[model samples]
Target: MTIYRELVIHLKEETMKDIELLVIYQNAKTLLFHDSKQTNTIEDFVTGCIHHYIDRVKHQIDLSGINDLGKPYRLQNHLKEYIDKKGISQAMLAERTGIGASNLSLIMKNKNQPSLDYFFRIWIALECPPLDKILYRVEE
Candidate 1:
């Protein structure tokens, strides 16, 4: 059988058991076999897979609404959680806010802090509520 066919069968079986495991399988398989630009070393492959898995778990946490009240409002964490919950892609947000994709990525990663103007633009673009737990809250 072809590799793709084998992967399909394996994924089908995995999906019947756990969706998270299926996602991990698919990501690791793609990184190992499909990407031409992936690093050659086993260490790099393992590290990349771990990073990919962590990112997926983080997204799942956001999607699952783990937003605890009274936590400090962090722009990167809150923005990512909001966007994930609302099913908004970074590319879509960038287009809506008139920010470049790279800039938006940096903001999301907390590598760069957006200006107040950009924050307002993001708020408007995301259509966030004024008193949103993740996005904003009025301090007493």
Candidate 2:
């Protein structure tokens, strides 16, 4: 068995649960804590729960001489979707972020991970869209 396995937990909406939550920061592979003690916004709390729902199919892989969960996690982002939906051109975004068009293209396609500086510049340029809306975790 893997260190992490599938578990479907149902919680009532009227109250909060004391569950631990981990979230991916933007397109970066780093995980951020989004538990009750740290989250300041409803969006963070809700998205933490959403990540739990999405992480429903993790399994074992042979490696590491122990419980190997494997790389079932993928960085999913909607930068291009938001840009297109908002009718924001790539050139305009580049100008707003002061990043090159090619770099922005790489970030949008999830082909490359942007620096923390570049990530926030792009996020802020987009009018501070909810972090969850722009990025999410998908387990495969």
Judging by TM-score against the true structure, name the best candidate: 2
Which ten-residue region of model 1 has the weakest summed lDDT? 2-11
Highest-scoring model, lDDT: 2
Tens-place lDDT digits, model 1, residues 1-140:
65522222233654545655555576678788998444244334445676888966665433222255565544433687778889999999999999999998988876777898988899889785332334432222
lDDT of 2 by residue, 1-140 (tens): 66855656566654443332323232122224333343234455556667765653342222322233465655567899999999999899999999999999998888887888998999999998766567755565
In terms of lDDT, model 1 sits at: 0.65
Give the alpha-carbon lDDT of every model. Answer: 0.65, 0.69
Tell me the deviation in Å of residue 9 in model 1: 65
Query: Where does candidate 2 stray beyond 4 Å?
Result: 1-71
Each model's TM-score, in the order given? 0.40, 0.48
